[model samples]
Target chain A: MSAREEVLARLRAARDVGGSTVPDVPRDYHRTGVHAPGSAAAVERLTETLTDYRATVHRVGDLDGVPAAIAAVLAGSSSVVAPPGLPGEWLGEVTATVRRDDPPLSVADLDRLDAVVTGAAVAIADTGTFVLDALAPDQGRRAISLVPDHHVCVIRAADVVSSVPEALARLAPDGPLTFVSGPSATSDIELDRVEGVHGPRRLDVVLIVPPRA
Target chain B: MTTDLGMPTVASDPHGHLRGTEPFPVAAHRALADTQLRQNLGHATRTIRAKRAAVVGEVDDWEELRRAGECVKADVMARLPELLEQLEASVTARGGVVHWARDAEEANRIVVGLVRETGSDEVVKVKSMATQETGLNEALGAAGIAALETDLAELIVQLSDDKPSHFLVPAIHRNRSEIRDIFLREMPDVDPDLTDEPRRLAMAARAHLRRKFLSARVGISGVNFAVADTGTISVVESEGNGRMCLTLPDTLITVMGVEKVVPTWSDLEVFLQLLPRSSTGERMNPYTSSWSGVTPGDGPQTFHLVLLDNGRSNVLASPDGRQALHCIRCSACLNVCPVYERTGGHAYGSIYPGPIGAVLSPQLTGIDGPDDVNASLPYASSLCGACFDACPVRIDIPHLLVQQRAAAVEAHGRPTAQDLAMRAAAAAMASPGRFSLTERVVKLGRLLSRSGRIRSVPGPGAAAWFGARDMPEPPAETFREWWGRRERS
Candidate 1:
């Protein structure tokens, strides 16, 4: 028989003999919740976990106060990096110089930018991780969210899920998805934890609660 | 169809010598004698084990996440061929190339040729188990190309010329002082004065590796997952070095095991949560990089994915044994294994070590006689279920270990002495008459000691039992004989 045929035979034999057995899941892995908590509860949980990881979280009750919140975080920054698809309402809160990430910005320009603000694709309520697909209007080239020292991400309560399985069911297949659990951190140096080795130093989560219907 | 990172999977079998064609007793004996190694392993494993337990306990849903991870891997393995073809189609459509290998030689050749085409002598690497298993670094060295290990622990191991002692911490067998000595000796153009302080050592390494990072044109890596639904390869790491290697280079080559595929991008959720908690004892790792084929202006323009088999198909053959492939390389099992705590990873003699290694090595490269340590690998574990409990994939490792041992015994045709002992034991056990005779003979020994302990014994049993532990002596009178006498009275 040919090598290919031999491989095929072996694979066929393996399939025939190696019948599938359902792997034993631990009995105590109870994730079933009859009433999925509302978006507000999820946002609250996200903020709590985010802060627990030492990330700075800001709360904006309305779009009107967003600029103040962004400005307060930026304090006297020379310029702000903004994605081309960023919502106008989101940036009305920031007073810093706005530089769109769409244009070819020099390394010096990126370094000078105080921070970048964008929306997440999915936010896991279980682990409080935010997913960015670069498809969001405000989320620019992957590098923009990554290279900047500070990153501010907006999350709606409706996008939150109780667990990763629930989150996986929500993410789309044909897009760029970047899951941000917390600010970039490393423990490579003798297991002594350090923050912002390559990515953002400060991560601010803006848990925007939609008005009651 | 190109970005930056150069392809270094071009080198053939960079780690070839590690396959363990040597005898297990010899390898294990040498490893056990290293006092420094024992101290290093004992300390390193204990520390990681405690941290993992503490972090894992904090999350109530850890078991659920582990189950999800295991199920997803099983599903992928079941539908692997179709998923792989789909992955290839998606990658090819997005302007990426895919290469297939049946074994280590084929894989090495494909990678080496690719690197030779890049016309580069050095390549940066992410810590990839696939490369380690295939011996890609050694292969690269043979081809006169240097494979620079960028992961901190891996870098330390490479500089010291020692094998990785643990899955997660490669230099787990080295203490701070040893690491400092290795750096001072091996590091090119080092400062005259170097302290044993970790931060200072890290700074030195950073300074040392910074030039390699900037200068290297090619990068080789292994993926944590390759999403078939979207045609993207993903890497999850604690260090941003993975990102630098993934991004800055001109050509990129990723060697992925067939078992690392997931059916959809959505499935990443299960693994994202599982890998971090199990691996680094964290809620989430810092950097997770995913790229599909190639993009016009960002990341590596020339992308090549080498689909490695190397004996995974053989593993997928056994009924109970196939579950070994579901492991996520989290190293949680190693951290919890008591046997692994003492003997360490080097004793296993495979790139994949610990409980996973016990079952996996025998299957991958069959249970061979004479110079094969892989056969004896099954005996390295104490059959404790800690590995199974700690396993993120929930592989029933003890069951597999027993199964492998059975296969080994059958293959070796059984030792004559063991066969004779088993026959005698069975005969004694089957008949009450023969058993009573043996009991009567042992009754005199109980007269010597009132204590429920045996000081020593004579013959083969004595030698085997007394080697590591003490054995208790026999009783004064047989129960049957005492009963008979009472009935007569």
Candidate 2:
């Protein structure tokens, strides 16, 4: 028998012998938090959680506020890269050399950039996590956000979710997803968390909340 | 670059890092003698324990989440065969080739062949417990392929030719200065002024592995969770090495234990919430990359998923023992364990260590005899029940430990001296007169002790006790006798 067949057979025998007890998955855990999605309370909680992990979060008022927010965090950056779908006006205030990822940037090309700007697919308020879908025109490829030292993620109001389950619902299984909470960190050294490692060391989240309805 | 720890043997499949060089007690004895190991383990575990407590405390529904997590894992275990088939099909539909291996040797053979086919002599790796379990790096090395461990702690262990002592931080046994020394001695073209500061050390590693990450042709990692419906593979890590290895490499080969497969994409919500908080005490880890098979032009063009069923089926066959397969390799149990805190990871002698390893390793390879090295594992725990509380999946580790201990005793065939002694003591305790007489006899040890602690006992069963610790002085009177005197008064 093929290895696959034999292995499956073994598992079947084990399940049979163990008297396959189909377990009931109790989903009573809080699927949603106290705050509603995209609510001011949710965004505030997002900011608090992101800042708690040492990521600088900027609460921007609509699309016009995004470019300045992105630029402010990229003050000392020499070069910046963003997806082709990112509005050119978003980098209008930035002095850094701009390279839009129309043609996907090589890893070596990405390494030279000081900062990366990309729009997120979804943001989770409870965990302060944002999902980056590589297939998404705004998010571009996974490497662009990762290789650069600084990552400036623009999270629009519509994209914010209240919790993890909500975030998963918004994301597709494909698109090669990356869930980033904060900048790269390691607790490997004496289990003491020191932020900054191989990934973007400085993460700046631009919250583009709409004007009060 | 593994240490020369002896392989645990059951004769059927004698591979993987499930067993250590010697029995747990003998290895633990040596581990107990090392003050440095103790201090390192003590500090690291305590630091993580506090961090975990704080983060876990933030969740109002943490217990509810744990119950969901446990039941989901149980469901996965019960229906593993079907779930695996669905996973294989989904992954195949998305342009991944699925390979199954009955044991470690087959798994290694399949991986080495894939790497050889990629024609890459070197591969960068994310920290993976599955590969470590199968000793894939050693197998790759023997096949003339250099597998560089990209995670900082794993790199330290790999560089020094040491074994991982902890699940998350492989080099938790080594202090910062020791790491600097290792880097200085081993890392070529390293800066002479590199200090023991963690950030500096992390920067040094970033500089070292950057080129390899950028250029590596093949990458190997273990799956944290494989969504059976979506065929998505997830790798959770604090450092971006996981991102580097997962994205940059053209050909990605992931070795996943069969038990890692989850039924659906939504299952990840529970795990994603449970894992980081439970493992590193983060609301969410720094990076969690999920790819369903191959993602064309975006990440690795080619992907391979090797499903390993080394000893997991054996663990699953036994109803009570099946909970061992529910482990997500969080190492939360380890960080909170008293025995693990004292002896560190090395004493368990397996790649897996701590409270989880005690029940897990022995079951992975059945206890062969009374003296089998893995047999001694069930006895390694003090069974404080902290491991159960700390476990995100709520694996009753103490229950499993006692179960494994029973299996060990049964595996011993004829009654051992300890078994006989317990049986005899039980017999005496069943009779009121004999119970009093037995208590009187136990109190006789006080006569031979000057310091009220028995240093030695001239008997067959006493050697194992006296070798490590003193026997406490018996009470002056039994409770029954004291009750009788009080009634008379």
What 10-residue stretch in candidate 1 chain A is worst by lDDT? A26-35
lDDT of 1 by residue, A26-143 (tens): 3345343222544666667777777767677887666666767777777766567887787776777577788887774554466567788888776766565777775566766565
Alpha-carbon deviation at A52 in model 2, angstroms: 1.8
Q: TM-scores of the models, in the given order?
A: 0.85, 0.96
Q: Candidate 1: where is the Cα deviation over 4 Å? A: A1-9, A20-38, A71-82, A87-99, A103-118, A148-162, A187-196, A201-213, B1-18, B21-43, B58-65, B175-216, B413-416, B440-466, B479-489
Shift in Å, residue B320, candidate 2: 1.4
Best by DockQ: 2
Badly placed stretches (over 4 Å) of model 2 are B1-16, B436-440, B472-489
B1-489: candidate 1 lDDT, tens digit per residue? 112121111112334434564655566777778887778777777666676777678677777777777787777666666677788889898888988776677677788889999999999999998888888887888899899998877989999888886667777777778878999999988885998776567667766876676566899999899989789888887656676677657799999987898888766766776777777777677667787887655557888998876666667767668889898888888878887877777877777778887787778777655235677778777797999998888899999989987777777554645456677878887888889877876776775553776666566655554555565676456678789999999
Model 1 chain B: lowest-lDDT 10 consecutive positions:
B1-10
Q: iRMS of candidate 2, one decimal?
A: 4.1
